[model samples]
Structures are given as structure tokens and as C-alpha cells.
Target: MSKKPFFLSIILFTIFLFLKGNLLAEETVKITLLYTNDIHGRMYPYENSIIAPETEKIGGFEYLSTLVHKEKQENPGRVILFDGGDIAQGTLYSNLTYGISMIDLMNKTGYDFSVIGNHDFDWGKEKLGHMISKAHFTFLSSNLVTKEQGEFIAGTRPYALKNIEDIRIGIIGLACTDTTVFGPESNISNYYIFSGEETLKFYIPILKEIHKADLIIVLSHLGYEEDVKLVSKVPGIDIIIGAHTHKVIEKPVLKDKTIIVQAGNYLAYLGKLEIEIDKSTKKIINHKGELITILNSQIEPDKEVKYILDKYREKYEAFGDTIIGETSTVLTKIPYKECTLGNLIADSIKITAGVDIGLINSGGLRDNIPVGPVTMEKIYRVYPFENMLISLDLSGKDIMEIIEQSFSGFHAILQVSGLKVKYDSSKPKNQRVIEIMVNNKPLDPKKIYRVATADFLALGGDGYNGFKKGKNLQNVMLIRDAIIKYFQEHSPVSGKIEGRLENSGKEK
Candidate 1:
């Protein structure tokens, strides 16, 4: 009997010690989120100085893979890798292969979840569907809805839940509404994009009332400003990882209880977010954001990824090197002003569309075609936006108004073909077009005229709202395809300086 009492006492004391130790220990959980956005299909580091002279060779998938591996080593099982969006377009490789290479690279990198960017629809919904089906991670886009099956579309989720030890995190996604306005017709023609705020309002209750997630994260393709608007309107969001505008943020900007961060375009920077959450409440107690530059000199790429990249490179080089045509002089892209190359592209469009005049936005010109014998590569280098050639029939009065509105906010130099105009820079806004002509004939306000321009400018974007009001708009073909056809029909096109400027009325 005495031995039984002693044994019971020992058991009680052991239980007491165990409970006391656990109370004192109070283990803390820490998680690190590593992210990239606007990785514009740059599978390899930039090479060929003539093509990309100003920027250093950097941001290859090989280097990114190596960095991810190193970060994993440093944090063991507590690290998560993610991409915001825009992984589909912007390079020859992306354009040639229709985003397959980027999809393959992203799958290899093991992205946990991503939102659908506007460019993701470049190859249309079918290709995007295939990529989503093939992706190893979840693709989330809440605002995208479908009526095909009277339900949501394929390859998209409103949100994804991640459980790291005892902490529960809910990551939601929002794509930009402008995708409907600016994206290719095939991608978003059938869909309706709802306001991000409205979508979040419905989901916030679900996440909080039902799922009980500890932290809420938003994966948004909406630009930084839109994300800021989202934070201000929606309550309970903890963090937002943004893309679209390609704004490189060095640190997280706090708005009330929410934090916003964006890594710049072209995979040039990786955003690392380190967070400490309270064990009981699961709310963030501490957070830090760091933007890591993917500089060539600083990073040594992983050999495995490099080898795989080499294999893709070998396959791409064969088709990419095919000779097409030659350029007599260099064609460059200067965003603030019209360049000679910009004029050439606009001229080609005007000629192809059989329009009276042509205009192209400076932002549409992606790169410079170095002065030399032009090739297929050179054409691809100069006009990389892949915008379609849209011809619109406008009265001379409408054309003049467009020109005036274009020069409203900033100095917009028009690259013209088959047109002549004189401007006074000192003139007030919308009155700068001092003189206008069509094919050496003065413009008649009542006379109808045809004009050719890219689809991007026609939508009132790039500060060209005058185009949206124009009539008889017709989209004939893609800009690059038109250029290619132009060269094929009229080989050896000689450079022409169509002096459209005739009179300068009191220069600024």
C-alpha cells in the first residue's frame, strides 16, 4: 500500500514538471516569403551588348534557382517561394515559344502560387489553361469568372491556404481590370473583370468566419496604386504582393495594418519578407522586407539550372538566328521622344494598312535595331510589344484633335508618314498643331481620312484618348507581322526622311 502511494506521487510530480516546462518554453514560429514579379520570360542572363548595351547581364533563371536554393539552405523548412504575375511575355524566347519556356522554368523553380497577369493571356485562355494544369503550384485569380459551365473557369482559384506548423495563412489573388481594356482580344473578350474590392468583400467573410486563417496575403497583378486602394478599402488584409507597373520597392510600405511590397519588372530583384507571428493569435508581430538585386557579378548561378537553360538555349538559337531582312540605319526607342526607328515602324504600318498616316507610341518600341544590315532578329528587337495594327477612319478634324491631345501632358513627337504638320511648342495645350497636311495636301476639316496606329494607343492609354473617339476602327494584323509582310513585299526598303515639319510658329 505504501509503495502505491509513492508511485502516484511520482506520476503527479512528473506531469507538473512537464506542464511547467511547456509554459516557460513558449516556442516562437517564424516564416520567410521569397518572391519575384514581372519575370518577363528572361530564362537566361542578358548577353549581346549591341542588343542590351545599357543594362548589365543579369536575372537568369539559373541565377534565380541558385538563390532560391541558397535561401532554402539558410531557412530549412520555413521558406516559401512565390511569383506575383507577368511571367508570360516580353522576350524573344517568350514570344517565339508562346510562354512554354517561361512555364517550364517557373515549374522548375517550384512556385507555390501565382496570380494571372494580363500577359498570361497572350497565348489565349487555352494555352493559359494548359499551363495552369501543368503547373506544380496553384494559380489563383479571384476576380476572373466564367459562364461557360455556369461556374468559375479552369486553372484559377480565389485563394490558397498554407499551413506552416501551427500557423494558417490565406493568400488571395487579384488581376488588374485594365487587362480587359489593354489585353489581347482573344484573352479577355469573353470575360468580365469585377472590381477587386467587391470580390474581396465576399471572400473576406469566408476567410475569417469559416477558414479562420491567421494571416491574409494578397497576390495582385493590379499596380501599386490599385493595391494601395485595396488596402485602404478592404479591412483584415495583412500583406499585398503586387505587380503590373513594375515598381521596384526596396521596403514594405505600411498602410494601417497592411503591408505592401512589389519587386520590379524583368526579374531584376527578389523581394524577401521575413515575418514573426504570435503563436496564439497568429497575427504578425514583426515584419521586414528586403529587395535583393540579381546582379551578375554578385551571383554564381547553379550548375544544374545552367545546364537545363543551355539545353533550351540551343533549341531556341536555331530558329532565332534565321535571317529575314536588313536595316540601313539604327532604330532606337526613346520613350520621351519619337526616334527614327519609331518613324520607320509607323511608316511601315501606314504603308501596310494603306492609310493616310500612321502613329506609334514611344513605349511600344522595345529595343534598338543597331545600324547595320537588318535581320529578322533586328525587327524583333525594335518592335517587341506585339501590338496589332489598328486602322481607323477619322475626319481631318478628329486627327488634328488627337495630335493636339497627344501633346497635352508631355512632349509627344509624332513619327509620321504621308503627313506634314507644324507645331508651336509654346502654344497652349490642344492648340500645338499650327499646321496639318495629308500627303502634301492641307487637311480639310470636313474631309474623311484614314489613320494607322497600334491597338494600345487606340484605347486611350499612353495618353491618346482622342483615338477612342475616332470612328471606323479596324484591326488588320499584328504590328510585327505587318512589318514582316512589308519587308517581304518590298525587299530592300531604302531609308526615307519624309520631312513632315514645314512651319514652326514661335518655338518655345
Candidate 2:
């Protein structure tokens, strides 16, 4: 071959290479975002309360693992997975290991990063440290900090900068500041959490300027409304994956310059967001999101994740399955109102403590008992907390204050025994409690009465401070133990809505 022709051929090949590189750079990039929030330690499948037929159950790490793996397989390197905290402390399996089991499962579930939720701190900072140490994914939180030093918890960073498919993505992490108010005193005392707006204000600049992030995704554990508020205050975010409210946002909400979506809670649904980013502007030009209800009937459980789940299950399932008692009526939890289940729990405490009154927060009571044999696992689902009983002497006036707090709309309304509480929902918060009759006698301010409640209330959990003024304080037995003992003695028991808590007024 002639030298001129060879050199000409070489120049044409170099031009082709340059053109191809530029064309690839200008082309749009597609990325699939997979997210779950507030798994709440649902290691196994259970009846889907929302879905019909009572037995069309959903959720479980096994089915979740299969769905997620399939998505990753379909998309390859374009898929990014994340969680929105609260991996532990809801079910028996999670409580067995104080969240380490869920962490272990998430490690296999292929999480990229997550933000801490209030419940994630329920076991306290020490146990949270263990979760952090065990998580294979990055823990990101811009707001969670030590009370004294104002530093992010060890093993957690303010945010993570990831380069996926040549796109620089920044994920800002924020936890619910209300954790300080709702979480247990011991768990919250060591840390101060910041609101999402302030945290985003501080970290957005760093991500934009320092890391040069092309896309900013906020993994927010703040409730849905709060996420909207944060977006209003600060701009520049492209996406927000939110949790904490357990609000099933079926569609992504588009605000100013961002889109917000939450998967709901308890591993019931996985949120998927498909977006096409402009190669030049680096903005999400097209996007669609949906919540995939994790129905075990539809998909085969991933074997690897199922093996891990089984390992944890075998360790705890045997004892959790022990039949404790039976219920003739369904003990349901009607939120923010007096419930039959609450009455049973409150009655258990009252009878166990031999006190004049027994009370439990409706917020503390979760799930309902079916009309059949009640197992230890069912009881754990209802009362998952480790709250112990506290016997305290309170003046009728102090007792009045506690009743007022229950209707104050801060926490769930109180469940009561030995007292008939009449409340008007239309009235203002503190004034909602219209009348209280102790043992059918009108509450007298001067009279002193022994009261039974959880130690969590005495410590001001759920913003209930009236229990703080209680005198003759004595710690009784674990509420869980009292419940079990009640079940053993009172099989085929029924908790009816006996008008212990009567609503005199209607909703405004």
C-alpha cells in the first residue's frame, strides 16, 4: 500500500473515533431507581391489611428480594437501590437481634444507601452503632448528630456522591427531627436531629460545588408533608425518596424542580422511578414512578435472600409461634381513638399492677388479633415495645392533666380502664377532655389515686409530660410479661369497645 493512502486511512479512523466519543457523551442516559422505606423488620409474609379477602397476604424480604433482583437484572448497571430507614424494631424477628438481622438481610437485599428514621433509633445510639457497623451499604444522614459534638454518627456520612453510568449523583440524607420527641428518652438523649430544610441548606452547596453532582436525590426519612416543606424552602433537588409517614404515594409528586415519592412502610411496596436524564443539561427530562405491591403469590422468592431470611426465621420462629391465648372478637386498632385492643392491654396493666387506673397509648398498640388462637408472635406484633409498667401516685388533678395530654393530638389517644373519659374532638387540643369519671365518680382534684402506665410515658415519650409529675414512683414488671400472663390465665377473652372512652363531639 502507498504511504499517502495509509496515512489518509489513519486520519479517517481518528476522526471516526472522536465523532463516536462526542455522540455517546451527548446521548441521553436512563437510570432505574429502586427504593424501599420503613421495612419495620417484616422478615416474613403476613396478611395485607389493605388488600382484600383477609388472606391475600403481601410483603416479606423473600419476595422483595426477587422483585429487586429482577429489576437489577433487567437494567444492569443502571439500577440503584436504597432504603428509607426503620429496618428494625417492628416485628419479633427484628427485636430478636435489635435490628442486626434486618441489616444482614438488607446487605443481601443490595441497598446502596439509606436515611435513619425515628424508629431506627428506638434501640438507642449504641444499638444503632451496631446496625451501622453491620450495614454493607452507606448510611447517610445530614441531620443526625451527637448532642455535644454536632458530628455525624460514626459509619454515617452527610451524603454520598456516586458516579453511575458517568453521571455524578448526590444523595442527601435526612432523618425525622421528631425522633427527639417520639423516640425513647435513652435513645434520643445523646443526639440532636435537625429538620430537613436546614440540613438540605447546608449540604446542597457542598454537593453542587464540591462534588459537582449532576443530579441531586434526597433520601428523606422526614414525613411526606415535611418533604414538601423542605422542597419549598430549598431548590435544586431532582428527586426525593421519602419515608416516615407510611403514606403510599402512588404517583411521584412534582414540585418546583424536584419529584417526591415514598414507597409506603413495612416492605409492603417498593418504589420505582424511571428517568431519562438529559446528557447536556443533566436534568430529569422524563420520569415515571409507581409502587409495586410485594405480593408473594405473584413472584418466586429469591433463594439466596430466602436462605438468609430462613436462617433468621429458624432462630426466632419456634418460640414466637407458641400459642398464648385465643380471642372471640377481633381486637382491632382504630388509630387516634379508643380501640378494643387498647382496652385489653390497659386492663392487663391495671390488673397486673393492682392500681386504681391503667392506661396505654393507642400509638403504642399496633396490629390486631384475629378471632382465633393468638400466638406469641401476634402479641409481639401488637405490643412490640419493651416498655415496663410504672406505678405512680397522682392527684386527681395530675390524672386530669394526663387525660388532657392524650386528647392533645400529639400522640395517639389514650386507652383507659377504671375511668370513663368523655372527649369532644371538635374542641381545641388541650380542652378536648370534657369530663372524666373515676369509678363512676366525678374526678376530684384533691383526691389522690394510684395510676399504672408505661415508663416510656413517665420519661416523656410521645410528648406526654403529665406523667412526669407522678409521685411514689415505682417500676413494676415488663408490660409484655403482664400481657403474656394475662393470656395464659384468660383464654378465649374478648375486648369489646365498652364506651370506656366515649366521643362526645364530632370531627371538625
Candidate 3:
């Protein structure tokens, strides 16, 4: 052949090889991200009444572990497991052990990382530090800063970088700023929380520019609305695993190429997000996500996790199994309205503290009491905060102000005893309380009355700032203990809503 033809052949061969290599590099890579949020220390399967009406056993660490392991077996190295936070401080197991049991379970189940939640600070800073030290997985939160030192909280990373099959995944964590207001105030008083948007703005560019991260994920303890806002404002995030609202997102929400997923509370569901990325461009070409219900009958329990859970159950069986009381009426929690269970709890506080009025935030009532029987375990699930009751001497004016503030926000509605309140939510805030009565008489501005409320309120949690002006502050007893005592004395108790709170407005 001629020299020109030979040269042309060599060039053609080089171009062919280059194009073939580019095709191979552009091939899509599939990654599966399995996540859980707001587990709240559910180590064993139990019937969750909130998720379903029937008494079918639902979520547990064992079932979650089985699902995770099976996913890993199917997908191999492409599977990554994570938790969204609120792992501690829900069940008797977590409360009794101070979160160690949950941490061990997370370790056994092979969690890659988790974010910090407000409830994780319930036991105090030192205990939170202890739990962080014990956790085998990394904890991430980019926005939490110390007050005195102006540094990130110890034992937490701002972000994490993981490499799987030539994919550089950057995971950033953001915690809720409400921790200072809703958590143990003293424990978090030394820290200041920054906004998630600011943190993302600072970190996303760094992850993309310096770290060369192919994909960015956020583990956020911010609620659903906040997560939606974050994705709308920030441009680089690919996925957000959200918690703190206890929302059951049946399907992942996608906005502007970002996916948000939350698996409700108490391990009722497991969230999974799968994405096929164009390796060359580091962009997701296709993705799908779903919330998988952790039904015990559908998924077999992991033997090792079940064994560990049994050990903890055996240790706390006596306290958890004790009969607290029985209720003739179903004490259900009605959000944004007066609930029968809330009435019972408020009544318990009034009787225990010998106060003229009892006030408790509705958010403190977490679960409904079944009519047939009640146990310490059931009560703990209802009132899991472990809040102590405090007796406060407040003038009728201050009490009225507190009630008005509660009516300002739907979630802040106060459960009450020894008093009646009628509000028109259509009216402007700070003026929503239409009428207030104490002991069947109009509230007197000057007269002082004894008020019993949780210490959380006395410290001005949930925007009950009027409680701060309370005088003669006295610690009465643990609110849970007081309720337990009331149940012991009032077995087969009748908890009913007798129109103590009436919304007279046209708006429902």
C-alpha cells in the first residue's frame, strides 16, 4: 500500500480508539441509597396504631437490617445506608439506657452516617457526646457552632466524602435551628445554630470545586417544608434525607433535580432512592425513590439484631410491662384541637401539683391511649419527653397572655384543666383568644393563680414566653410519674373532652 493510505489507516484507528474509550466512560452507573429517619429507638417490632388501625407488628431494627442486607446483597458495593436522625429518646429502651442501645443497633445495622436532631440533646450535652463517641458511623452537621469557641460541635463532621466505583459522593449534614428552643435549653445554651441555606452556600462550591465531588447529598434534620425551601434556593444538591417532622412521604419529592425523602417516625417505613448517573458528566440521568413499609410479616428479622434487642427487652421488661391504668374512653391526640388524652394529662398535672390551672403544650402528647388497657410503656410513648412538672404562681393576666400565645399558632394549642378557653383563629394573632374563664368566672387580670406546667414551658419552650414571668417556681414531679400516679389512683379512668376549648371562628 502507499504511504498516504498507511498514514490514513493509523489516524482512523486512533480516532476509533478515542471514541470507544469515551463511550465506555459515559456509561451510566447505578447507586442505591437506603435511608431511615426518626426511628426513635424502635429496636423491636411492635404494633404501631398511628400507621394502621389493625394491631399488626410493623417496624424494628431486625426487619430494617434484613431489608438493608438484602439490598446490599442485590446491589453489592453500590448500596449506601444512612439515618436522618432522632435515633434516641423515644422508647423506654432508649430513655432507660440514655441512647446507648440505639447507637449499638445503628452500628450493627451498618449505618454510613447520620445527622443530629433536637431530641438527641434531651439528655444533655455530655450524654450526647457520649452517644456520639459510641456511634460507629460518622455524624455530619455543617451549621452547628459553639458559642464561646465559634467552632463546629465536637465529634461531628461538616461533610463526608465517599468513593464507590469511581463515583465521588459528597454528603453534607444540616441540623434544625429549633434545637435551642425545643431541646434541653441548658445543654444547648453554649451553641448557636446557623441557617441551612447559608451552610449549603458555603460548602457546596467547595465540594464541587476543591473536592471534585460527583454527587452531593444532604442529611437534614430540618422538616419537610424547610427541605423543600432549601432545594429551591440551593442549586447543587442532588438528594436530601429529611427528618424531624415525622412526615410519612410515600414517595420522594423532586424539585429542580433534587429529591427529598423521609420515612416517617418510629421506623414505620424505610426510604430508598436509586439513581443512574452519567459517569462522564457526573449528572443523574434517571432516578426513582420510594418509602418501603417495614412490615414484620413481609420481611424476616435479622437474627443477630433480634438477639440484641431481646437482651435489652429482658432487662427492661418489668418496668415496661407494668399496668399503669385502664381508660374507659379512647384518649386520642387531636392536633390543633383539644384532645381527650391531652385533657387527662393536664388534669393529672393539676391534681398532682394542687394548682388552680394546668397547662401543657399539645406537642407533648405524642400517642393515643387505647381504651381496653394501659401500661407504663403506653404512657411513655404518649409522653416521651420526660419533662418535670413545675408549679408557677402567675397572675391571671399572665395566664391569659399565655393562652393567647398558644392560640396564635395551630401547633401551640394548650391542653388545659381548671380553665376554659374559646378562640377565633380567624382573628389576628395576639388577639385570637375570644374568651377565657377560670373556675366558671371571667379571668381576673390582677388576681394571682397557681399554674402547673412542664418545665419545658417554665423555661419558655414552644413560645410560651409568659411562663418565664411566673413566680414562686417549684419543681413538683416528673410529669410522666405524675400521670402514672394518677392512672394508679384512677384506673378505668374516663378521659373526655367537655368543650374546654372551642374554636368559634368560621374556619375549622
Candidate 4:
């Protein structure tokens, strides 16, 4: 063979190898996004009473850690772990530590990022700031700003950029605007939660054009409906990891071009979102998403995380185990109508405050008290919010207005004691109250009445504006403490609905 021909053949082979390598590098890439939302400080696996029977054990930080490790091992560098906020402030473990346990656990579990949930501020801004500082991962929220300072809360960013396998992924964080209203009024009064749509409008374009993100993922604490509406309106978000609503979305919802995934509250489910991105266009060509139930039997608990939880358990076991009292009947939470639990709580507030009437929002009741030994842990679970009892003086007319406001929204019905309310839901918005009786007598619009309620309502939580207008406002005691006191005085308590709220219209 001629030497020149041999050299030419060698050169051609080398060029072919180089071009093939480049082409291979430009092929489609697969990335996996693992997310959990609204964990609510369920550090230990327990029965999912809302969804499953008492025999079924599901969700816990230890089991979630096992899932996280398995996912990381399977996907390696291609997997990203995130939490959609409200991780703190639910169970006894969280309440004891003020969410320090959750932060420490998430750090150990290797979370990449998280959005700010409204409940994260339940303990107040200082506490939330401390947790943010302690977190190993980044906290992102573009819309939560301080009203007094006119700046973003310290230590949180609008968005984050991560380069995964040569693709730049921008993760934007949008906190729920309802945070200002739903959270502890005193805690968030200095903050302004901007609309999610408005925040996205300002940030999405910046992420795409300026940051040059190949993919945009929003870690949102906004509810499912809000997330859907946001994606529909904004149009640039590629994926949304949602929280706050606690809806178990078994599959990803696709709206326009955006993919929305939410793992239900309390670590009951873990969402896995797999996306195939075309290298040329940098757009998602194919995607698959599903929620994996965190059943304790199927997945082993992570020993390391379990050890930390055990330490916390040892510390708080005394208070958690202390029997508060006993209940003769199951005190259930009825959100739409009056229930035994609501009546009992309302009565407790009334008796404790020595007020003529007591009112509590249906939404404030978090759990039910079983007809057995009532422990402090159970009470904490039932009333987890840090709301205090407030005594206010309001005219009978104001009382009627508050009742009408509560009945305005089907789910906003007020739980009451010392009053009987008959409402026709068929009636128009402001005219729903048919008749209101105080102590079996017709309401006197001109007379002043003493009312007791949670401070949350006194501050106009859940859109109860009438409560904010009361005269001679007095903060009594913590609602939880008052309930505990009531339990002490009335052991073997019986909670029964006594026709306090009468809905005359067709049942919804």
C-alpha cells in the first residue's frame, strides 16, 4: 500500500471518531425530579387516618429518607430532590422543636431546594428565618416581601440555577399569597405576599432571557388549583412542584406545556417526575410523573434519620404521653356543618373566657378526639395552630354579620356555643342567615354581647372581617391550653351537636 493513501485513510478515521463523539454528546438527556410537599412535620410513620384505616401505617421522615436514598442511588447525578414547603409546624415533634427537627432532618436527607409555605411562618418570621439559616439547601420565594422594609425576607432568593448534565435548570419559588391571611396574623402582618401570577410574570421572562435557563421548574407552595391557573396564565413554567392543598395528585397534570406534580401532605406520597429533554431544542420531549405512596411496610426506615428522630422522641415523650383526659364519644371535626368536636371546643372557649357566646372557625379544627384516653399529643394534633382565646364585645348586629360571613362560603361555617343559627344556603351571598338566636331569644341588633373566639378570627383570619371590628378586645389564653384545662375539669367529656347550626336548604 502507498504511504500517502494509508495516511489519508487514518486521517478520515480520526475525523469520523471526533464527529461521532460530538453527536453522542448532543443526544437527548433524562432528568428526574423528586418532590415532597406539605410534610407538616410528620417525622414518624403513623396511620393515615384521613385516607387509610388505623391499621395502615404510612409516611415518616425515616421512610422518606430511605426513598430519597434509593432514588439518588438509582438516578445518581441526574436526580434532584426538593420539598414544596409547609414542612414544619404540624405534629407534636415539630411543635416541640418549633420546626428545628424538620430542618435538621431535611438537611440530612439531602434536599436540593424548597419553597416557602404559609405555615412555615406559623411560629413567626424570626423562627422561620432561623430555620432558613439552618437549612442545608436553598429557600426560594420571589413574592414574599416585608412591608416595612420593602425587601425580600432575609436569606431567601427569587430563583436558583443548577447545571445538571450541561442543562441549566432554573428553579423559581412562589409562596402563596394567602400566607398573609392564613398564617398567624401577628407573624405575617409586616409582610406582603404578592400575587403568584404577578410574581411569575416578572420572574419567568428574566429566568428565560437573562439567566438563560434551559428548563424552568417552579417549586410552589400555592395550592393545586392556583398552580394550574398559574401555569395556564404564565405559560413558561416547564414543571411545577406544588404544595399547600395537600391533594394527592396520583399523576402529573399537564396544562398548556407545564407539568404539575404534588405529593400529598404528611409525606404520605413522594412524587417522581421524569423528563426527557431534547438537547437541540432544550425542551421536554417526553415526561412521566407518579406519586409513590410511602408505605412503611414496603420501604424500610432510614436508620440514620430514625436515630435522630429517636433522640427527639426521647426528649418529648413525657408531654406526649401525659393523658389529658378521656372522651366518651368521638369528637369529630365537621368542616361544613356543626360537629361534636366543634361544639365542645366552642363551649370550652365560652366557659373558660366567661363570655356569653363562643365562636370558632370550622377550619381551625385539625383532627378528631377518639373515644378513649385523650393524651396531650392528641390535643396538639387536633388544635395545632398557635391561636389564643380572645374575648371581644360586639353588637348583636355585628354578631349576625359574622355569622353571615361564616355561612357565605360553604366551608366557612362557624362552630358555636350559646347561639342557634338557621341558615338557608339557597339564599344569596349576604342574605344566607335566616334566623339567629342568642340563648333561645331573638338577636337584639342594638344590644352588646360578649363573644369568645380564637385570636386568629379576632385578627380576621379566614376572611372573618367582622371579628376585627369588635370593641373591648381582650386576649385571654392560648386556645390549646384552654382546651387542656377544659379536659382536666370535664374528664370523660361528651361532645355532641345540639342543633346549633341548622341548614334548611338542600344539602351540598
lDDT of 2 at 115: 86
The 10 consecutive residues of candidate 4 with the worst lDDT sum are: 179-188
Model 3 clashing residue pairs (backbone): none
Off by over 4 Å in 4: 1-26
After superposition, candidate 1 runs with Cα above 4 Å error? 1-27, 47-55, 148-150, 179-181, 325-330, 371-378, 385-387, 404-442, 455-477, 485-508
Winner of 1 and 4 under lDDT: 4
Model 4: residue 237 alpha-carbon error in angstroms: 1.2
Off by over 4 Å in 3: 1-26, 53-55, 179-181, 506-508
Runs off by more than 4 Å, candidate 2: 1-26, 179-182
Candidate 1 per-residue C-alpha lDDT over 288-316 given as tens digits, one digit per residue, 9 for 90 to 100: 99988777767888777777778777877
Name the 10 consecutive residues with the lowest summed lDDT in model 2.
179-188
List TM-scores for all candidates, in order. 0.82, 0.92, 0.93, 0.93
- What is the Cα-based TM-score of model 4? 0.93
lDDT of each: 0.77, 0.85, 0.87, 0.88
- Report the lDDT tens digits of candidate 4 across residue range 1-508: 5799899999999999999988875698888999999888888887866666778899888998899899889878989999999888778888888899999999989999999888888888788889999999999999988888899878999999998886899999988787424666336767787888899889888988999999999999888889989876887889999998888889899888889889888888888999998888899999998988888888888999999999999999898999989999999988888899999999999999999999998877877888899999888888888888999999998999999988787345889999999999888998989999999999999999999999888888877888888989898999999999999999989987799999998766
* Colliding residue pairs in candidate 2: none
Error of 2 at 480 (Å): 1.3
Per-residue lDDT tens digits of candidate 2, residues 385-492?
778889998899988988988877766778898999888888887888888999889999999999999988877677777788889989889888888988888988
TM-score (C-alpha, index-matched) for candidate 1 = 0.82
Question: Looking at model 2, how many pairs of residues clash?
Answer: 0
